[model samples]
Target: GTRGPLAGIRNLGATCYINSLVQSLFMTPEFRAHILQWRFEPQQRHAMNLAYQLQMLFKRMAHPSRGFVDAKAFVDSFGMGTAAYRQQHDVQELNRQLLDVVQTFIDKAGTEQVLKRLYEGQFYDYKRCKRCGSVTATPSPYQDLSVAIQEISNLPQALKAFTTPDEIDGVSCDTCNDKTTVEKGLTYRTFPQVLTIQLRRIDYNRTTFERERVRQDVHLPLDVDVSELIEKSVVGSPNASDDQDENRFELQTVIAHSGTAYFGHYYAFTRVKRVERDAAVEAKRLEEGEDATEATVGGEWIKFNDERVTVATPEEVEEYIDPASWKRRHVVHATKKKAAEKTKRDAEKKKEADNNDSNNVNDGGDAPKDATEPVTDVATTTTEGAANATPSGNAGMGTPVATDEAFAFGADLFDNTGAGGGGDSDAVAEKSVSGSSYYAIYRRVDLPLPSATIDTASLDVPEYVLEATKTEDDELSRDAAELASLRSVVSVGLVYRGKKHWVSCKPETTLHELTSTARQVFGIEDTLHLRLRAFSATMSVLGATYPADFTMADTGATPGSSFTLLGVEATTDAAIAKDVWPTQSITEWDRLMPIRVYQPEKETFAYLRDLV
Candidate 1:
């Protein structure tokens, strides 16, 4: 048995092969379905997949054909029936060849279109010279129309039809000879302002498509500067951070993407306002004896020697010289010395007249009986008194009596004393009253009052302590009795809240002032209640419970009966008739809403809420 198995292995070379029939039987419908399901869907994707598969299949089938097997062989190896395999292979080959031709046409057309768009809307035609191969550009269709037409007529009708007029001029380079011409035709197509490119992808029965659009604003015609637009829109995004390197990179990318050359749809049409040259007229002007510089050619006038020329009218002069230049030369004529002298003389004369007027008026509307005589005997007496008033041992006498009188009548004159003495009795009285009040309080408390004196030694309290104490007393007065007294005088309630909020019915008092005070003290959102009323004898007496200094007694006397609140209708008819105080109108009260108070120290409304 061992010798038999070894002998068969040597002769057959241990061959292992499956029969075609067995392979076909093993290829189930489920395996074929799996292959078909994975097939690429879009035409492009499908073609690519097929190409790859063919390459792989050829590699495995390498031999004399180097694995480049035909489509027929590929189908047969897949176990497809012979007839179906042949038919499918033929169809696929035809489709592959057709696609190759279509791709070539598409590539050619795309290149041509791009070139045409680049040269669109150009006014000039460009060509190379045949003689020297030098490039030239020209505006008109024919460089020399007369010569080109003559040459065209010499040609046969059939040849002439094929020829086009030459437009470019020859460049006068040293290497070029001006004898030959190159014949070429220029054709162009303009590009649209906005270009949209659509990209499509399809795979495994799924498709995705995206469209990208690029737009350009042609701000100016041909050869115009677009640097600003490029710097702004192309260089950076409007929202990009200035401090980031990425922002700079993004800006550069955008600029590079948008900086492509574009030939617009329409040609720029421009007409230069050229100043014509008139050689003959200018030559004639030069020949004239009158200054050549003053001569004019055509409508333009010339100037010479800085001399003024007589013109028929101001308009003629203006036409010859710039209007702005004429105005600068003619207007605002004045010399500094003349202006200063005039001002000085006028001031001097005014001073003299004022002195004369003063002397006449002081002389009782009459000229002085003796010019240089003393104006009054009182002046002499005053001078004598001042001279005698000086102390005996003083180095100099007191100010001259006449000078003193002059000083009194002039700017620096004032009495710094009280009555006949240079001391303030009222100030002393005020200080004494304050001291006596404080002393009386201290005596009652059995704490000795500090001594009252003008010198610093007499004061025992520190300056800051004294200031703080005074401030505290002032604040206390303001918060309580003073504030209540002021409110009564104004006839306005300062309470903040409820109906009749921030309404002032008091005479000569406005709703604005009451609400303003509430906002200042409470907050913008705080509610306030204010009421105005005609004073009644009883309420007026009760108001007097505050202080006379804070009452509005000047407004009017209070009646002995009940007072009525103006602008506020009573809630009910019975209430209106009754002698009760009226509240504010419901509408006015509804307008106010509470606001969160702004507290600077605590930096929030938390402190305000806690205080409330």
Candidate 2:
């Protein structure tokens, strides 16, 4: 978790599901600003008024009075009934209901256009008769789209699956008196400024007759083409943009759920778009001799987990979605291993070329400007740990590898630059999020952000809120002071066998102390000797071997940094055993690390032996 700048929401009992939804919406700048700009009438001001409570919650979250704000007031005012308030509620269901309530409140205020302008989308579910050649269209309005997760590896695939046409057999057509097969599917009539998608990960199992959560990994693109998913051939379809830029939608928020259908915890990772302050703020910065262009803040993502909000990387968000996907972990290791081997080969080739050039120069001949072999740009994969990459092959022969250090945690393991080498590095840098995304928010690039019609300064500020702000300011000052005085203790990870474990140590803690702690934690006997090596999961390659005399200060080890332990084997049978698959009851199967097996649809159960 990060100690970065963003306020959090405190969960009141089993209210984390609510907290996740609240935080995600608050981080959407345009929406937050719109809510804060609401002008409530004197008669509408009441303790049970949802809109007023929401405005207050957004006000406090934007200008946090403390590290976290109490959301109990908003919860009490939500009017979700007593039973719903007392327990954890489904996020998707609550999300739609909350929007409906907000729309209702704004409708009375005559500003309901804000909700429609930001979220409302029109779609048509159509059926075409084959015999009579007649088409029927049913127009519907939706604020969000719920897509299925079955048989899809990514979001685009899921969208296509949702919109793809299927045959409806033995159906009576309105135009045709006899039954005939009909083509049935949905097409977009209009797209919204902001699009929300819910990945339907929970499906009913036919064998067990129960609903179960699907743990399949579904990749979520940072930018998606909404136009491509729409059926353009339909007569009244929204005009498809010839310019691809206008069709793009960038991701803003991801609400991830962890645990089972009965019990689960919800958290959100939201993107903070760059903000441009007014001229007055810019003038103030200029007067202080600060860079005028430094008026903008944000353009980063943050994780909101109940009372603890921290700065988050895209990789961290991806990993949090499907932390136990073995394929993702394996791809990371395999890609790193390939990159390391390439580096070594490139180094050896460079040395040989240098020696050959020296020999040619000694013989009074000019050295070649470029190598005879063709050159290619190779991408690197990284993880939570830090990594670096140098250009491979001959010098001055090809484009230097533009590394995206952010491509970590099961993203495209290697950022393939593709053929032309001119692809935008920034675009490649933010990899697609993978896993079961319960909720996703995307904003259209062509649409302008919402602007406030009323002046924010005229709003009456609460006295208690002012006092809380003062207290928060004092806390910030104390935190800054504590940060200046560096603490002695720090935590780092130790990867032993196939698992990683974290241990605490001081900056001055020697390699000897680290090894001793590792031994104690891993329950290794004193007789057995352990070897310590500096390893990076980011590179999936080993670093310089450390001597017992080396200290953490010497190595510059910090929090979230990890090392690998070598020269050790499993001490017991339990350590070597793997979790077996449950054949009888599917519910009893391990959800995170399920046993590998052949495709049930394509092969028999006997094929499992071959896979094992």
Best of the candidates, TM-score: 2
Clash counts for all predictions: 7, 0
With a 3 Å backbone cut-off (N, CA, C), the pairs that clash in candidate 2 are none
lDDT (10s digit) by residue, model 1, range 1-612 = 011000000011110111111111111122112222232223533233433233222222211111112233323333434443223222112323422432343324434332122111222244555665554444322111111111221212212232234544544444454544563433111111111111111112224343222221111110111112111221122322233221111000000011111111100001111123355774453343122221221122211000111112222222222222222222212233345656896699799999998886787655557888656677667767665766566615664466656345433245333355554222211110000000000001111111111122232333332342456445554666654544444333343333223333344444334434445654543332332222223322111111112222322423222232222221234433232222222222122322123234553332212333
Q: CA lDDT, every prediction?
A: 0.27, 0.64
Per-residue lDDT of model 2, residues 1-612, tens digit only: 466465688877789899999887876666666666666677876767777788877666655334788888789887766655568888889888888877777655644588787788888888888787687888778888899888777788887787788988999987788799999888877777788889887888899999898876776765688777777666546453456655688767789888776667888887654444365774454344342231222235677889898876534654533333323443445555566766896799799999998886799655456888554423432322223333344533543433354432333344344545453232212223343468888788765432212233544545443453567667765776555434545566776765677766677788777777778888877666565554546544333334466677655565334442322222234312111222321222222222223243453232233443
Task: List TM-scores for all candidates, in order.
Answer: 0.13, 0.54
Scored against the true structure, residue 202 in model 1 reaches a CA lDDT of 10
Lowest summed lDDT over 10 consecutive residues: which window, candidate 2? 576-585
TM accuracy, model 2: 0.54
Local error of candidate 1 at 415, Å? Answer: 40
Off by over 4 Å in 2: 81-86, 109-112, 169-179, 236-246, 273-299, 320-436, 447-612
